[model samples]
Target: MADNEQDHEHTPLLQDQDNNDNEQHNHHDQTSHRNVVENIRNLIENEIPNGHHLNSSSTPKRVHALLPRLFTLINSLVDCSNVEDEVVTDEVVEYLCSLGQEVVYGLLRCIESMVAEGQRDVGRKRLLDRRAEITQVAAAAVTKAFVDKDRMGTYCHVLSRPYYAVGEERNTAENAIEIAIRVHATDFIADIEVQRCVQALWTGLILQVEEDESRIRFVEYGGLRRSRRGLLDWFDIGRLNVPKYQNNMKIALFIFFLAMYTFVVNNQSPNPNIIEWLMYVFVCGYIFEEFRLIFEGGTAFFLGSIWHWVNIISYSMFMVSFSFRFTASYILTDKSKIVQYNDIAYDLQALLAVFLWVKTLSLLDGNQYFGTMVMVLQKMLKDGIMFFWLLAWVFIGFLQSFFALQKAETKDFNAAFSLLVRGFLQDPDWELAEVLDNKYGFWVFALYLFLTSIILLNLLIALFNSSYTNITDSSEKEYLALFTFKVFSYLKSPDQFPYAAPFNLIEVFFVIPFTPILSKENYKSLNRVVMGILFWIPVLTIAYGEQKRYEELTGTNDDDDIQGGRRRYRHLTLDDISVEDLFMIEDVDENAAAVSGETAIQIANGEEGAVVDASFTGWKSNGPVNETFADFQRRRVKENEARAKAAAAAARAEEASSSSDEDERADAAAAAAAVASSTSAGPAMSEALVQTLLASIARMEERQKEMETLLKQLNVPTAED
Candidate 1:
């Protein structure tokens, strides 16, 4: 009976456990089935556009239409947190590949709409809202697909499509550029894939601009005539006003006019006239513009560019030349001083011409053939500064030594330094040595020659060679980066009027006043219409008068019939360039090796090596003190225990000292109180109390000494003791 009762009790508990397990299993199955149904519903909702419905029978027939929608849905679902997201993404990508051109076209259209919408107020707000909730994730996904190597054919086709209808009537190159600029301005600009796509598009555009024969045409009479559409249209005042390019053109024109002025001033007598006044106006305008750029950028920007300093120096010389010439011609009364000032002015003008030519090197910095050499030269110049710094100290040492030893023979410090420099050049004047007649002078001169002429010169040559070689190896990449920066700088420039001096004045007088009153689109149209009207004056004049002059000078119509003669003077562009032709650095590993080599060289030269922490590569932890996390933890624990023990011992000693001090003070106070009370009572009471207090005081002192001894034994000293 007992065995039966025990079995029955255990049976009920087992049954209860079985029932709980069944409930859990059923709940799990229901959740899994519900998840499947929800996934299918989401897939259908996302893949099919609104107001569209499809049954299983129609799904097969609509697969073509569904493919793009499916890709778009997959792209949107990229940020969704689910186990099937990656699998779905891969499926969508594969499906896109199978669909080919249709899918690519759909993606491009999607991107275009997105970018166009993003540029508008209401559309931007909508996109911002969607982005806040991580909706509409298709842009980055589409960009990724477009940049793939296998999809290069598709990318090229889309870019070469020639028509982008962003509410524009005519299809033009500007429309294409607008699309590219919009895409570039988006969040995907940082992606390497997006960068490549944009770069390729820019390259194609640049090539088109360069090879565009529409800018020049043969005239019926004979001489070449500039076409209605010319290269300047890309940077026209009424078009995308890129200030950097406009400034470059203005500077070039200023230089030309300045040269003409210099020639005229030198060739003719200084007389006030219309041409002279025009020259003055141009000069003043150029100077004002230069200063405006300088002040706006501030000192750091000015000092950072070597070209800016050159500009400053050239401008200063020109100003001086102008002042001297003006004073000599108009203000001065003395004929001799006038002649003297004129001569000074001529010399200053000549020096300014040289600096001007040097400044033109900056304009050629984008040329592929010449740009590398210019960059190498710049690098060499920078490295040469340090070499000169070391040489300066050596030269000073020689100067001091020679001055001290040859003071009697040399006239001054300048004379002695000149002599030392001459010696370094290996052509020392033995007469100076003979005049000095000092043995130490000869020794010092010999040492200086050995240090500077042999050692320092060789070291400088090696440094220059190394820097040149390194720069040359990476010159293509550097030049490409510089060229891209120049292009982007022009594109991003905020200046609305990108015209040269007199023309800029027209814009300031007419265009600027109307800007606030009109919408940007309306303003651009009006500005273009006005600028076109103004431009025709020059165009007609050039076609008639200049062509006639050219015909007369050539004496033959055949020679003047050539088109594109003016094309050679325009800016450099990457004509006929392939996607693969873009230059990029490919030697990242070599950079680390170069750094190691530099460090070794510094050590070899007995110079202090720069402190470089190896933690950048986790090498710092690989040294003699390499320890695991467990080992570190154990060490920290032991240190913490030692600190705790020290603190506890100090606390105990303090407590003992404090207790002993309190006891001594209490005993002394008790004795003093007893004596005071007895004195207040009477003479008989005072005599008895005094005897008792003295005994008690002696006992307290004895006890205090004993406590002090005990404290000493315990290594815990009290203040009184």
Candidate 2:
């Protein structure tokens, strides 16, 4: 039993010694591991510092320190380990990767400090130098650590190209977006939304590229591709399109003119029935848009886009309506089975062609081919008389044909009968039809003769003469007298300002005088009769009024009063009148209404000096029987008239001079007086005059107070009254 107990105690002591040995080995192993960790930490800290100062010298030190850590990170991530055990290799890689991350973090903090200091110093020669240095070091380190250098270079190259996004101008954001788009770096980008931004930029860039190409092509070519081509090119080249509204208006105006010409000429066929005028009216709504800006002075631009579709539809409707009218009318009316007015249709088609030309105006620049074609007829037919004559002849032909057809129908004439009658009318001699056909020929030849001799030849001469005489006149006067009154009618008046010319006595009086006569509807000799009446009415009325007035006052029935009107008028001109005693009209005697002679001129001239003569007096002493009386009478009349005339003339001169203020003389006088006053005044003398004036003012005030008290008793307001 003792031996067993001793054995148990010895075993326990032996077990405790083994446990202590194991504890010591474990402690030694832990200490060695701690030493290894510290060595590794020291090595990492020596290579990568927490802070770095910004300088040329600091960069090399940073690069050298960062390289080892970068290599470690790469190798760790690559799992470059010689261990055959898969688990051990993974564990080693993870440990090394963690270490490398710490080193990388420390190095990055150092670089950040360096960059901050560099920015603060402004010690670099240029910003680019600072940026280049910082970027080069950072890029080199990042490249060694993680980024593939080849891919980054390609990315940078793409970023250099300017690309526009929302705005038309290419900018930095757009270039960055372009790089993202080209590289398909959507997944790599920090935010997914950036891809949409990149796409938008790409779309804008594509449009720009197309616009630039278009401009280059246009310059290479001789003609413009479109009217807005220049603008689009500018937009593509990153320039703003100016007066965009006006440009659009010009295009619309051209379109309007084309539409008008087509609508007027192309639809004139005597259709089976013309399209309802309502359809044309409705169609005019579209034509309205084309001209809306014209009435507004062609200043709107984008307004065209708002109604572009409407304009096109309206114009198309008009074209269709007219086309149907021409086709139906010609088919139904043709008796010969051949078109009667084929030439007319051809002319209509030619005019219709202008609409296409006008439409093309918007697409082209530089050359104005489309606009020219649309307006070509305006230049050719600008002569008003020529156009009027042509229109008149067309009207005459249409009227005669229509009347003839009606007459034939009344006589129960068929096509066969008409043909037979036509044959019978083809006689060689003494045939009325032959004479009418050969001589009249639709009245065209007669129209030509009348138009050339009367309208064109005479009016052209008159227009040139008037224009030459008034070229430098006031613009308002020229337009009012030459254009509105002479060529057209009273329609242009509403456009002029109320103060503008032709707001004159002549226009007011003469405009209404002959309107009723001119508007009379007489044929054959209408104009000749009208013009003759216009020329003579005023003259005859004035002469008759004078003659009757003279007869009434004198109670003399004398043929001499009526016969010698012109001779009396010349002798009693205004120049013969003396100025002092102005003559004016008085009440006319009712009994003298039938009297033969009176001249307003004699009254005016006689007012100067002459009085009624009781007995006959000679014209001069050399010719008459009562020589002494005539000489005395003439001397007295002449002396009184001379004095009166001088006084009246002086008054007239004063009135005329005062009518318009002369600014030059007034300004000169004012300037001279101002200089004199300034030079004459001085400080001390001015004060003395002021004091004397004040003393006199004080005395006047005292007297004024006494006068006011006295006036109060009389209830009068006055200075001293």
Candidate 3:
């Protein structure tokens, strides 16, 4: 019925297209939807070169020029803003899907050959040579197009509501996080080319913005309909914001909370003290947050993670222990009952202590390396679980065999289980010889040892090794992905208004009850006032640090000269050292001058984007002036952002036009919109950068002149003439 109804609904539109084609051409032409998509696919395939055909003339410079056009074509496929869900044409759907597939295929081809096709080292060693430059730049651009939405969350924007204005259409559509998971699931994480691309993307995407101003400044917040700020600007202090990055202050706050939790858990008694009671308040709030997370992330997501499983068991135990402790202290009348409840409570706490502290290691997510290590360990633990399941059945079978070998009353299950375990450990209890003197018992026991000890043990070992290798490469990508998950899942998890734990209890009890009765503005005002009072510490601390960072960033040119251009970069070099008698660091002018001079010559002579590979390790060029690599990467990121801005502008321009020809309209709009977006994206290009662009153009023009002269001298006809 639904299919017939849909066909009836769209029949007129289909008939109109059919009638137009019937009159216009007798057959569809290149201007048709299929042809347009095929053209775009061909262009995408050509950019990848060698994979589609043996074209060797493609260069990084050419890719850079064509990439912007490709993006504009893609963005113009479906007018996301005006396209209604029910009315979306299959032609537009095909175009969108085709673009995504062609882009992915191109990226795979580029990365796989990136290293093999490119190499040419000079006096100074380089990670990637000039030939591989196109591969790196193209791959980076593709990765950015896909993942830029991840950064859009930081803006918490007006333009990106309901869905991002750029790359989204429907509320029911799923975001492509499963791409990462599937890559991980299939053990494709170990592919070196893939990891290299991941590393480059990681180095650019995260290392640049991990300390961006996410939790500073008061601003309007929430959805289009339910948005709020405080009643007055002064009351609009940001106390509920969560940073996308794991900044120093956030790490410090987490450590402080954990420390307090640890102290209370170690020292608290059945009759809780004031401090212990405070900790209980915090625990209650934490469990509340977990429940909220379960609701927001969905039951499947919550249950899928092993950490959540641990959380469920631990929280259950804590609740049970609290019930027992309270019963023993106040409710229980009999002394014997009270003592028994007390013992049970202590035993449960003892077990919970093991769970909580061991889980703490997994929560040490401050460092990227730590996050990656935790991921590896978690994957291996999953592998170990499977082996244990098989081991359990094998052990049970052996125990049953021993039971049948002896008199029913005399069969000691514990003794047999222990003996089997010891034998597996290469120390068979020959003492069990008296119990199992029969040949059948002897042979079955030996067979059990061979199966469990030799075969199963080796299988488990091999599985663990495989799991390790699967996650061996791309640690930085894995780390950033983990943190991004935590941001979307827990820190920025669905809460109409967020309050950190302990303080959250007040919001739950007092604020939530009044929300239905209160007006939106008044509700927000209450939250603002309450948060301004409760979370003064985070607000004040982050506010001061943000202001100080701003001040430092706005330093004079003289400061830049003295510090070797440390603008926007936080890497510490010898110039950062302050001690007068510190001979350990090379802060003196002579060494600094030499390093800077070397880096300058390298940049002037070489033609490559910021490349991160094995050669980047102990890169001597990074030791001094970081202009050679890091600054190049920063410029690349800015360039990407500029493209996004340009696309958005072009989108508005295209919408304003009445032309039905999508491709023609996009080209015209992009030409008009590029000037505005480029100017607004960043500060004016430095004179040196302008000179470099001019020189590059001049060289290209000179080469073109040479080609024309050569062809004319050979009496060849020119296409232009």
lDDT of each: 0.47, 0.32, 0.47
Query: Against the true structure, whose TM-score is highest?
Result: 3
lDDT of 1 by residue, 1-721 (tens): 2443333332312233533434456776545433433322322232343312122221222333533464455345433334232343543453343332233334444455554565675735554334322221333444355434222332333222233223433212222223333343233332344445445434321211211432211101101111123323222232223233344555567677767766655665544456655666666666665665555434543454556677788778878888988999899999999989888887887777677677777777756867667767767777788888998898887777667665564546776777777887888876675455357766677777888889988998998899778766766554554444444434322243344665555676778799899997798687666766765443343335433433343233454445576322221443333333322111122234554686434422321111111100000011012333334345435434433443343343333334546565445444443434333322322332333333333445456678878999999957864
Q: CA lDDT of 487 in candidate 3?
A: 44
Question: Candidate 2: TM-score?
Answer: 0.18
Give each prediction's root-mean-square deviation over alpha carbons.
35.8, 50.1, 20.3
Question: Candidate 1: global Cα-lDDT?
Answer: 0.47
Model 1 lowest lDDT segment of ten: 614-623
What is the Cα-based TM-score of model 1?
Answer: 0.44
Give candidate 1 regions above 4 Å deviation: 1-237, 240-255, 258-262, 265-268, 271-282, 295-305, 406-411, 424-426, 433-437, 488-492, 501-721
Q: State the lDDT of candidate 2 residue by residue for 109-209, as single tens digits.
A: 33334345646767532432333233223322332222121211212222212322232322212233223222222222222222222222221111112
Itemize residue pairs with steric clashes in candidate 3.
Answer: none
Mind giving the per-residue lDDT tens digits that candidate 3 earns over 387-427?
Answer: 99999999888888886787667777777778788877888
Residue 219's lDDT in candidate 2: 8
Model 3, which residues run further than 4 Å from truth? 1-172, 178-239, 244-270, 425-427, 433-437, 560-721
